[model samples]
Target: MDEIVKQSLVKWPNVPSCTGWLLLDRRGNWRMRDEAAQASGAAGVAIRHEALLGFINRNYEVDERGQWFFQNGPQRVYVELGYTPWVVRLSVDVDSALALHDQGGGGFEPAAVFVDEDGGILFADRAQPARIAVLHDHDLEIFSDHATLADHDGSLSGEFHWNAQLALPLQGIRRDDVAARFGFVASPAALA
Candidate 1:
């Protein structure tokens, strides 16, 4: 595994249960096979093991290079190239910083929270609607709104690309939790 993937796994053990490989092209673009992208929803996307604790609402945009920017209310979080595969995971951590990890189970920590199914959808194909995950941390009174899947055909290096948006409310986490640092991780698919 690449250092990126190893570091990511060590930092956040709950890798998103992706069905196929998610790739970042050399030009810093992110891509997944159409089938894989289609299968992976916001739920399947990776998240911060500790993020289920706060309130978060954010948006995202991806350039041709696959570089990503997350806008949460007035704040903007940037994910550099080569770290696209860990976007979902980072969303969770960002939420935790806001103190949204409230719900538990489903392979997440007990303090971790999730939104109702009606709030979002996971898109398996371009023709499908995007999936969303809402998480909350009751003790911290934090909530997060996240979208994990999207379709991007534009290639930065003749490869596919993908991006997403995540939002969080600073009020959700403790007032002291505002300066939480964010990071990324990428895990390679296991061989069959």
Candidate 2:
């Protein structure tokens, strides 16, 4: 977090949180959602300002409830996630090892990799399974490289075997169960 943002919080402590006003799109773009755009179920306008993007990234954090938000000075602008909490892209450093660059602006190596029945690739942290991310569809080749088809009863599912200790379940886990199983509420608006 930025020091200026911290000081702003101390100086003006009562700013109400703003939800449904900002969104992090599936392609890792920052968007500003207005009332009209939200009501019409339209995707918000993408924010292209580099400075603002940097500021948001610097102040971004997840609450105890797993709701990620950008602290805009005194106000907390809750982000509407298009997918998982972290949206990742394939990293540039492909020679050393396959890597992922999280939209949150960091890189990490997953302890295990999992592929859902629908071909969604999920990366699980060694320490925290809840800290998972679905790989963007743009990088489907990576998914192909890491996963193999498995027979779960009669249902065929893609299974990723990265290591011995981290094994994805034999049966396919449904998309609806993902949020609950991973300890995150996909739509925080429903809670409000």
Candidate 3:
């Protein structure tokens, strides 16, 4: 959390939280939902301001109820998730090995891998399984290069080789069951 935001919280501790006004899209963009866009059920305009993005990222956190929000100074601006709480990009690090990084620019060490019916890849955090991360679409080819697939009992199964020695097994998962299976709420406003 930012020191300024902490000071604001102390100065005004009773500020009500705002929900459904911001969204973290599947592609890792922070979108600002206007009233018109919300009423029409459309994805809001992408926020491209670097400084604002940095501020939001610095204060982004999850509540005890598993709701992710950005503490905008004093008020908590709840975020609507497009997919999982995190969106990770796959890249080859300097050692020519697979690496995962979350949208917030944090390193993600995945302990489990899941593949949806649509072939979308999701990774579960090594320390916290509930903290799921979807692989950015642009990196699918990189993921494929490190994965080996096969048919097992009429279902798809695979292994993601992060390096020569570490292999994470990929399990089949349905798109609709992702949120429930992973213990995350896609729309915090609806639940709030």
Candidate 4:
């Protein structure tokens, strides 16, 4: 949390939370959902301002109920998730080693990999498995190059080669069951 945001919260502790106004899309884009977009059930406009994006990322947090929100100084602006809470992309570090980074530029080590029925790849945080992130679609080809899939007794199994030294087993997951299995709310607006 930002120090300025904390001070604002203490100064105005009764600000009501706003929902259905902001969204985090599957491709890691932060969208602004205005009344027109909300009424028509659209994805809204993607926010491209760099500084504003940074501020939102810095204030992003989750409540005990697994509802993700951004503290905009005083008011809590609840985020409507298009998929998983985190949208991750694969990148090569200075050592030319594979690394995982979220949309907000925060890095996390992947402990487990899951392939959904829709062919989407997701990574579970090594330090906190409950933190699931969907791999950015553009990185699918790179991910496929480092992954191996096999069939065993009519079921699918695989392994993601992190490098010459390590491989993590990949599991199968159903798209619809992701929220319940991983403990996150995809649509906080519906709950609200």
| Cα error of candidate 1 at position 59, Å | 3.5
Candidate 4 has its poorest 10 consecutive residues by lDDT at 149-158
Query: Candidate 3 at 179: error in angstroms?
Result: 2.1
Tell me the TM-score of model 1.
0.18
Candidate 4 wrong stretches, greater than 4 Å: 93-95, 151-156
Off by over 4 Å in 3: 151-155
Tens-digit lDDT string for candidate 2 (84-192) = 7777776435353556777766875676565566757667665554477777789877556655766656555755544334445434557677777777756566566
Clashes of 3: 0
**lDDT-better candidate, 2 vs 4:** 4
What's the C-alpha lDDT at position 5 in model 2? 92
The sequence of per-residue lDDT tens digits that candidate 1 reaches over residues 27-68 is: 222333455553552112333434321221113333233334
Which TM-score value belongs to model 3?
0.94
Across residues 70-116, which tens digit of lDDT does each residue of candidate 4 receive? 99999999999989999999976687689889999999788889988
Question: Candidate 3 residues 78-186, lDDT tens each?
Answer: 9999998899999998888777889889999888899888778999986654578999999999988888988766666879998777889998899899888877778
For model 4, what is the error of residue 15's alpha carbon versus the real structure, in angstroms, after optimal superposition? 0.6
**Model 4 scores what on Cα lDDT?**
0.90
